[model samples]
Target chain A: MVRYLSAALLVASLFWLAGCGSSGVSFNGKDITGLMPDLEFSLKGEGGETVTQARYQGEAVVLFFGYTHCPDFCPTTLTALAQALNKLSDQEREQIRVLFVSVDPERDTPELLAKYTAYFSPRVDGLTGDQETLRELTKRYRTTYSYGEPNESGAYLVNHGLAMYGFDRHGKVRLFMRNDQPVDQIAEDLRALVSIQ
Target chain B: MLHTLYGALTPYIFSPITVLLFLLAVTAYLVGWRRLAARGRPPSAWRSLSFFLGVLLCYLVMHTQFDYYSRYMFFVHRGQHLVLHHLGAFLIALANPLPVLAACAGDRHFPRLAAVLRPVRRVLFDPVVATVLFVGLIFFWLSPSIHFDAMLSLRLYELMNWSMLVDGVIFWLVILDPRDPDRAHTSRFGVRFLMLVAALFPQILLGAYITFADAGLYDVYAICGRAFAIDAATDQVLGGLLTWIPPAMMTIVGALVVLRLYLRYDSEKGG
Candidate 1:
């Protein structure tokens, strides 16, 4: 009985290992279909109005987490995203929404977030929430954020995720865009995402 | 102060299953220990302390705010596994709580359940199977793609942790069975030594690979964000070292314990 059981376990593990090989439509960005939960959040929008993911039910949503005080990666990533959006056709652009969720809610008020996002693109909408709500949203995506120690001037930095999550029109998670991904490739992936039924 | 303490003690992601299983185990052990003491066969105080301490360490790492850092930081994740799969599990198995646990099982209740589980336990405890599982799990989870997915999915993440703890306990139990092989028909000491040595080298190699790699191998930590502002390379190297050195030392300690057991049994038979 022991020998048979061990053999069965061996075979089962082999099958599991074999199943790890992924195959599908290849994109420059990592394909995350079914790997993450669907897009969902109830955050405070630019005007202090409550915004839920349900508001963007019929459009593709690209979600990013950062702070207005982020001096480097946040602006660079947002600019790259803006450039990517510029490459898309007018109608294609209309089908996508870029959400810049601020993780440093203490320093990034809704008005500041709105202004910061406006400098990037019209497709971008700024969002922030209370720390608890932001924590829940980040945890749902398997991401996290932390604040660094304040400097003598009371300035501090908030570290956050450097990837963008793409959700389809029907709110299924589809793509994982790394911060290092090229703008044209991001655009191409977004175009493909837009065409997905 | 009390409120802050409570916040730190609370689980970052509460798992009812973990809490329930831990409660059941502690309750059974306590009940069985008292029963044995009444019968004049109580385990030593040192053994009891080891058992409780082991369980407590595992619980603190798994159920407290420490779990949050493990999720977001590479080095903390390695430290968590080190406790689960090496230190904590090692202490629990070294305590040899089997007899006490069996006392709880007794002759009256769960006979059918014990009978059903006997074959499964036999298979898991087989020296070859135990060694393979002990080493294979490390490699399987550390594989970059699998690591990425496991860290992302809550169910898979929980499964990964629980499997490491379960497999670690089983492997150590096989090595640290207090019974003499000749009389108790337990696994041979030589075979147990072989299992320890076999499990050691692959871990060393994997650790070295991660530590020496120029580029960051685990992008998941970066993508998900880290717990602090430490460099990614520094975190990876620290995690690699944690994976490399302490576990190898534990294996050596385990072998020495096995050698002592062998000598004790030998002298008992010869004298």
Candidate 2:
């Protein structure tokens, strides 16, 4: 009777003691690992060159959907991405490419988009397409965007999704990193995604 | 120049009410100690030290960079929570300042004060009451609406922090009284140990929910923009982890201490 009670108590204590220590690799972002559908589409990169998911084979690709004129979200996210990428070694940095897809294709011409993205980091490539093509591409990812009516200056803002998606070397969507994550954490998640075979 | 001044002074900005309240507590403790010495019943060195450390930590958590950063970072906020509740409360309970205060009030006897405080103390220190208030306050503040709203209003934020500190002191005092003269009403060490252990389950459950959550629970942090540029989701995860881990370790240590004390008492009694 005494032995049984002691054993039972010990087991119960263990249950209460359980937690805190993670049993697996803890992710800083939502682990949509292997959950997202294949990212397949061809978009026009700078200089009107066609860019496809296949082009980034054997390297981790990061995609952000926003316009260059976004005063806060786009510039902040791109700056953070630049800092996060800077934390890595030259070799590790080479294995990653950041693509900024401008939702406001009307104003974000190929040249303007290229120059804007290049200002943040050399590894960042600006991707854009015409209205229908951009709409279809965004639709594939279940992303949303809406253009406000032009103001007194005949300029309008495009509101769009603020999430960044990470694809592993095999082109599988692994990270759904949010815009607010700190640079170090994003860097850590990027490192993990890049390490994935 | 104004921006630079504001930036430099932001971290040291302490609320007038908080400063006043803590200063009053220090005055009471000091006056109480002096009275105790005059009566030839000076407090133990350890208890005095423990109480002072607790008060110091309270000031540090509230007035320092910790509080300033907690306004921005989830993990730092969680750290502030831990200090206010577990460590500060534990050390203050070890000090057990009530008797000292009573002594200071009227040279070891404050009949009028006792009349008012006695019943209040009885209800406040009841084991079940303490546990419920402590645990309920934690969950109440952590609730998405309250947590989110608290960030928007300075008064609500102060209320949340103060309540946590008060309830923590109340809860820990019940478990760590050291001399429970009313044996029947007070919780025994074994029972207190069990209660602490039980508290860990819900705490860990909450932490896991936050850590593994698919979406951000506190939208204010995201809306305000993370000052550190920490992704909101990542900040939430790290905060959840901090909430889950340190409290469990503290509780485990507390339980072990209780168990050891229980064993020592039993052996001394030859039971």
Candidate 3:
């Protein structure tokens, strides 16, 4: 009986240990290392050319999903991201890229996206895709987006994810930053993520 | 139009294990029902209907596009668990499927399989173990940190759902066993009643805690975005109500069933 009890205790402790597994680097954001798939998507880039995850190879990528017309979350989060990037050293900033993928392909053309993303930072790229591609990408990441009914003025709301996913240099998913995280903490986490290699 | 309907009906995440288990169960039940009918000992239609409805409800929640909403919305996830862990499992146990399943097995094939499963069943069906698992799983998965991880990881998410489902079936089966404890050595009806009541309070406490909390207990839905635009607090409250009310009602319903069983057994002995 004692032997069986010890075995059960050992097994329970092993599960507890497994549940607490981490990547050894702390961040203000939720550590999601190995919990999600590597970054991958094919979308229309701001240059009117097809772009894929391959273009961002060898750089840390932050991916956020929203509509260009998102009145609050999009602009606020982008601004916060810009501020976070400003806190990083130029050398650290050089290694980071932020991809803002608009889910409203009908309204957000490449030119509009380019202008919108450029307002934030040169390192930020705007991309949008057809509904099918967007659905696939969002589903892969276990997030989703949906458009609301258009009102009298032809404006509609597009609900999208507020958290940003951070991928390491090798494109392995590593962190998830919530919209409420502070700019300084975001920058600190980015700095730690940058030094992972 | 048909294409859109088909897309909605198709599974959000297909699992062969789930499909196979469901198919095998349906086939076995049908075969056994036919055999029993031939023997003039068929179960009541209501019981069979309960079994099929229970199985189908579980399948629909886990396999259909409903799963997508459950993943992205807190309230829907709670509803899915309500069906899986309470209503669906309750109906299935109420159907008393063991006799039908045993008839299908017929003591001919898979003796070794039965031998292997016997010890496993013994451990799982222990009254204490069953009660702990039934309540503990709800608490375990709803822990904010664990809930966040389960929502993110596909494998963990699947495990979480399947565990709740399997544990629910085991727990309800223990409580709703049709055999008389004096004759069949099953759990005493009083013990089953205690298990139901024991499992009830923790759930009520947790649900009340979630409902009345000032802030969102689960951030995964916000992080992943919702199926539509709804306030986080509203969503949490709805999820909390789902967690609180229906399950407590199910516990009462289960207690009533045990009481009826006890009364029936007492009369049988007296008469």
Candidate 4:
């Protein structure tokens, strides 16, 4: 597991890691052995470009999986995550990143994901792609998601578990914050994990 | 702030010494929530709240100091009284059965306290007991002789304050018994309104009493006015109105709101 994560980190740093954004570390684009598996996947962006795992390597990341049409859990989790981030002092908090991954890739073009994630937190980075890529990423991340047929409004929803992964600066999952936990605790946990020198 | 109230160490059932104690009492239910979520654990919220409240009471009694409010406007000081003792403490009791005495019956005090607190609980939990205590509390302070006596002794004043706070809480706890299955609904809005009503109902009557009462009451307060130094009668009425209005509106209307919410929740659940 450890090597797998390290490999992902190394490979991801190749194309991205530009302006690691005050997180005080940058991926060498060299995969570290015995860590996270390398996950090179194609994704859509609002302005029509490819987003890959490499884009987020070496940054402390908060990753959540859901679609744009979620009713309760998605919004609640996002709101809670934003609140947790808000609890910290600006400097300590700014050294973090949030990524939204769309499980319902069939309809969740990168554009939809980007717009949806933006509603909750400006720091959020949304990534979506073709069906195969989304499926592979979701499976690797252990994200639980299921799709429902489109309803009358031509929009269907996906029910997904609201779990967030907290990654270290090295792009390694360090802590798991459940959606239902209090925001203060979540923020504290995130800051503590990131502050670990 | 904790330093201002001496004998704050001696919690006295209502006025706890430290904010830390208050936090503990407030967070007790979180333990129960976890238990329910995991092992189907027996509820420890009641015990936790009781212990926390006891800690506060002990802190208050040991270090009771009134310097902070004593320095401020008298009304604000009294407002503090109506909040911590009367409202805040009661809300804690209703939300969690800080059945402090009921739970940790000290081995030594077991027979004695039960003998004492049992009747007290029976009467307190009863509506008639509540009404009488509530009425008696109103009149006791209103009477000049008793009022003067209360002012003369800090202990007396503190005792009355504590009693009123506890009695006030006990009164509503019985009225809006959260433990009662029929009254308790598993709805967030219902619970919130339940809290609002429990707080508001008493205020309505008290507000009415002060708004139109003919005679001046409470010589201790009338003679010794606090902030903005109004006349004794005016202060007394104003105090009554202040006490009555917000809490009453919160309690009754809040309850109805809760009932509406409860119905909605039931409809949603199709139960």
Considering every candidate listed, which one attains the maximal DockQ? 1
Ranking by lDDT: 1, 3, 2, 4
User: How large is the i-RMS for each model, in angstroms?
Assistant: 2.6, 13.8, 3.2, 34.0
Residues A1-197, candidate 4: write the lDDT tens digits. Answer: 44344434533452132211222333211112112233345677655688766776656777777777778777888888889888888886777888777777767676777788888887787777777776556545433345566778888766554557667766654554556678877777777656745
Instruction: Residues A17-66, candidate 2: write the lDDT tens digits.
Output: 32122213456975654334556778888888888888888888888889
RMSD versus native structure for model 3: 2.4
Error of 3 at B51 (Å): 1.4
Candidate 3, A117-190: lDDT as tens digits = 99999989999999999989998888998889999999999988888999888888888999889999999988
Candidate 3 lDDT at A117 equals 93
Off by over 4 Å in 3: A1-21, B1-4, B34-42
Give per-residue CA lDDT, model 4, range B1-271, as digits (tens): 7664444433322334345544554455454345444545444655455435643543343234332222112233345445544555445454445333333443465678778876555545544445555555655553455544444334455555556566666655554443433454323454454445444454566656655676454433322223233444565565666666545543664366346645765776685
Give fnat, all candidates: 0.73, 0.00, 0.63, 0.00
Candidate 2 achieves a global lDDT of 0.76
- Superposed on all Cα atoms, the candidates' RMSDs to the truth, in angstroms, are 2.4, 17.4, 2.4, 25.6
lDDT of 2 at B77: 84
Query: What tens-digit string does per-residue lDDT give for candidate 3 at B1-271?
Result: 9999898879987888889988998999998888788889988999999999999999999999999999999999999999999999888888998888877876585476678787677777888778877898899889898898889888788878887888899999998887899989999998998899899999999999999997678988987889988889999999999999999999999998899999999999999
lDDT of 3: 0.88
Candidate number of the best lDDT: 1
TM-score of each: 0.94, 0.57, 0.94, 0.37
